[model samples]
Target: MPTLLRLHTDRPGHGSGLRLAASGEIDLSNVDDLKSALADAVAEIGSSGEELVVDLAEVEYVDSAAINVLSAYADAIHRIVVHPYLLSTLRVSGVTELVTVDPVQQ
Candidate 1:
């Protein structure tokens, strides 16, 4: 199996937003890790009023289990920017309404 998950966080300054960029595959095997990572990221933001941006530009695959975890965390997250490739998968799986998806750049 590929390494499949990379999480990077950045806090620019006081009241600045936190960016959680995820790369690689998110499947049943690593769905728990993804959930844990998101939980930790949410904790780090800690009601500071800073926005949380989750960038899924590098996620190549997402299984149903991953979607369920993401759906559970959607309300807690500020925004979810999923790559274009995953949008259809999410929609088909009925998870698009649970989270927001930023428009993919051309």
Candidate 2:
């Protein structure tokens, strides 16, 4: 079965930060989309090198491949906002160490 993933990139409302909104499951089927979304978000910010914030609020599941995708953007991702339950997934995947994981009790 194919997982459905949706990615929307836009500038942050507060500042020049890039925001990538990811919805749906993040598995092997859609991990590449996540990566492309982040990359596109960064590119949209030009040469600012400011920051990329991934909003994982609507995300339901994240697999190992998805974690690896996030790991690759560790340097560019400033913060990852996720559901409280997803905190364990990020920590276990070692993504918390690379980037900031802000768990929002949703």
List candidate 2 stretches off by more than 4 Å: 14-16
The numbered model that scores best in lDDT is 2
Per-residue lDDT tens digits of candidate 2, residues 1-106? 8899888887656776878898889999878788788778767776786777899988899999989889988888889999888989999889999999998665
lDDT of each: 0.80, 0.86
Model 1, stretches more than 4 Å misplaced?
1-3, 12-14
Per-model TM-score on C-alpha atoms: 0.85, 0.90
Q: Against the correct fold, how does model 1 do in TM-score?
A: 0.85
Name the weakest run of 10 consecutive residues (lDDT summed) in model 1: 97-106
Best by TM-score: 2
Q: After superposition, how far is residue 42 of candidate 2 from its true place, in Å?
A: 1.8
Error of 1 at 29 (Å): 1.2
lDDT tens readout by residue for model 1, 16-98: 68878788898887788888888998898788777877778778888888889878888777777787888888888777687
